[model samples]
Target chain A: MAILEVKNLSIEFGGLKAVEDFNLSLEKGELIAIIGPNGAGKTTIFNMLTGIYPPSNGTIHLDGENLLGRKPFQFAQAGIARTFQNIRLFSNASVIDNVKMANTADSNENFFESILRTPGMVEKERQLDEHALELLSLFGLEGQADTIAKNLPYGAQRRLEIVRALMLNPKVLLLDEPVAGMITTELDEMAQLVKELREKHGQTIILIEHHMNFVMPIVDRIIVLNFGKTISEGTPAEIQKDPRVIEAYLGGGFHGNA
Target chain B: MKNKLNSILPPVVLVLIYFLIQLLLSKKILNPYHIQILMFACVNIMLTVSLNIVNGFTGQFCIGHAGFMSLGAYGSAIITTMLFGGMKMDPNLRIPVFLLSLLVGGILAAIVGFLIGLPTLKIKGDYLAIVTLAFGEIVRSTLRLIEPIGAARGMIGIPKITNLAWMFFFVMITLYITRNFVYSRYGRASIAIRDNEIAADAMGINTTRYKVIAFVFAAFIAGVAGGLYAHLMTFIQPDSFSFVKSNELLVYLYAGGSGSITGSVLGALVLTIIPEALRFLGNLTNWRIVIYAVILVLIMLYKPSGLFGGKEISFLRINRDSFRKPFNKFNDPKLADKQNS
Candidate 1:
């Protein structure tokens, strides 16, 4: 069975349909990329998946459990975690704090325990700090853990967002433009990291990106979107040969190494 | 042993300070007027620090804190004055009763805070401010219509039972609880909500829940302060907990530094004392407010983050190792070089 299944997903803003009849069936540990131009509604689909926006028509299931109209945090609790296209980090917080904030659902301390700082609560907090530091180190953010998040370079900020998302221990991880503003080296590092996340941790991943080079080499499958509709879905090599995807997004003069 | 010392040291210090103040009172080094100012300062500290939980730490604009305080004041006063007014109770028993009444007041204020927060906290920025402002007016106007608690004319003959010891105890509790909440997971959730609502939500934080928690906790503390205030003044009036009182708390929160607990403490203490100190200039005392206004504006202009700049004093600091480790590593040239490479 698929880890996540979305069928006939649609959303409308007034008279205009933002996303229509979007369908996805992500198997466990499968990696996919949603490629589209700006305003092509790639993010709208992600919004629906994460329950940030309730779809006008859709059925979404995570591990065979229906998740139609839940809140965004509920979606997160149900094990779908996502980073933002615009890098929505906790900017004023320290780097470690930004990651630890995501562990709210996992914490079991009650009001009294927190107020009194009981032994159990103190132990839990220490463990959470250690785990957060471990994740930060994985992303090469251990040294920067104490720094305010906004002070980090753009690439680091993007990675921090991913680290924050990963703290949820989601069954499905969504990376929205994870390597959006990165230079060549940062892009390569991000690609390597995403691949490592999937291969080593078996993390089911979906990402939205415009960079064909970045998306092609890493993602197992590609779904090209145009005007809120899926234009093509296949392996990266098959996607490169799809005439409709080429005409709509890549243009006639474009050539791909794949 | 070190952990045990950390736990025991603060209370010992607080007790010593209390005795020192008592000595000053006995020696006539501090007059009743000075004591009154000090007591008011304690109440203000409670008000400002509690307000900071919502306004400063949580980044929620709550201008109706005095409403919560008023509820606490009235709730506790009714117990002491109307419920047990004529009874000749033991002085020792009265202390417990007074503490119970304050707790009742705090809980009452917390209930109202929860009610207001649930509906209003969903809205952000200026809208929340306006709703809170309206809520304050509603609380005041409603209190005026009620006949039992003196109605519009106000309640009088309330016992002045709040002493330096009691005030000090409550202040310490307020500071300790607030500091704990800020350092706890719950406080981190609130801070995350303040930093970025959308991101915090995505990170599995129930933003509304944390906002309401911060609001309700703040209200509870403000309510306790209100109870202390009523006992101190010995007279109660609906006009006392007006919008102006709420505004005064906001000034303290901002002037002290909104996000820092130390800032709140200092802001309330200094602001409360400055006006009293200026009373020596009897003729110019009225102009002292003008001087106060000037100082506030200067602080706002020169050090906009407040005197502490969202940084706590070492005594108030929790997670000491985390505090020291971050800045040193963050500013290290070798770390920067490593990140670049």
Candidate 2:
């Protein structure tokens, strides 16, 4: 079943429409990729999907529930999460602190419990620490758990973004250009991680990727956008052969060779 | 046993130290003027810590804290004069009524904070700050216009129920509650919003809810401090809680280091006492204010983020490590038995 369905999504800025008549129906556990040129409004669509920008016209339904008129946190509560294109993190906080903040979404303990240091609250706090450490370990970030987030190397920062996003345990994860700037090794590791998320955790993913090689092999399906409109949609093999995609976006597609 | 001893020792030591100060006061070793200054330091600590919750941790610039304080002052003062009518009440009855007045003042300020915060907090940073400053001014002018509450001439002959003990108790409560709030999920969520609102919201944190909570809680504590201030001076005045009072609290928070409880303690305690220390210059009481301003400027130059530099001392960190094992032992019969045995 389609876990998320957007019909005729549209948004405008000033006089120009940033994204128009966009349509998407993502199945549960499916890995879908949105590909386009620099100004093709890919990020804009992600922004709308994640409730950062309210669409001028369209309906976004997650799990058959209307996502319109809901706050970003409410969208998150409905099991949708996203990472940023520019990597927004609590830069002053430690790496573990970043993950811990997001992990709090599921914690139900109150401040009184914290004040009195109740046993259950303490155990829950320990669990939170363990869970955050486990995630950091998965990303090879356990050693840097105490390091301030902005001090980490660029690659680590990118990885930490995913770690923070995953902390929400979202059913549908929207990763915006997850591997925008990465070496070959980091790109491969991220690709493997993305696949693992779907295969192991059954996480439904919608990704925006500029790297052709990264987007081509991993995604079950490809969505090509040009000039704020859906130019083509099909399997990667089909998308690779589509003439409109070649002329509009591919032009043999941009690849970083990772 | 060492851990148990360590846990029990700090509070015991704190009580002993507290009593020593009281003993000195009772013996007249410490003059009443000195005691008054010290008590005022404790009250400033409460106000500073409360403001830090909103401005420092949540990253909102709230300059209307004095407005909440004023509300609390007036709320409790009205109760004191209306209910008890005079300062010559029985000691036992006076203590409870004073405590009750603190509660009334805190609740009244909290309600006003909710009303103001709900509409203003939804906007951007600068706008929220402007609105808060405006709120403070509005409260001040409104109080001035009202005839019954003594207007600008001030409410006189109020009960002077506040003392060192009362100040100490409220200060500790403020510190304890703030420390707990900072380590809690709601507190982390507030910090997250401070770091990045969009990202925090994407992670399923209700940013508006946390922001408002922090604002209201800060206001409540500030109100309680205000009640203490009114009773401490035995007077209530609208002009007492001007923009200057709000700015003074902010200065104390920044000087101690925002986001650090120990810093707030150090900042408020020291800053409150500095002007009095300068009085030794003799007939230059106003020069103390001038020197205080210069020191603040120097502080801004050399230690901009404040003395602690945003690093918390964590003596009262709710030590999750301490909380974990023994606390859980209560739930597990086997663990409890093992400990007992």
The candidate that achieves the highest DockQ relative to the unseen native structure: 1
lDDT of each: 0.89, 0.85
**What lDDT tens digits, residue by residue, belong to model 2 across residues A103-132?**
766898876786665778767888897688
lDDT of candidate 1 over A1-258, digit per residue (tens)? 999999989899997988888899999999999987788899999898888999999899999999987999999999999999998888888898899999998898998899887878877877787788779877889878778899999999999999999999999999999988788899899999999999998999999988788889888999888888988899999988889988899886466421
- Per-candidate RMSD, Å: 3.4, 4.5
Q: Write the per-residue lDDT of candidate 2 for residues B199-288, one digit (tens) a residue.
A: 999999888778898998899998899999989999878988999988889889998888888888899999999988899988878799
Cα TM-score per model: 0.94, 0.92
Candidate topping lDDT? 1
Task: Score candidate 1 by DockQ.
Answer: 0.54
Look at candidate 1 and tell me the lDDT of residue B51.
Answer: 94
Off by over 4 Å in 2: A114-116, A252-258, B1-10, B23-29, B86-90, B283-286, B318-341
Position A81, candidate 2: lDDT: 86
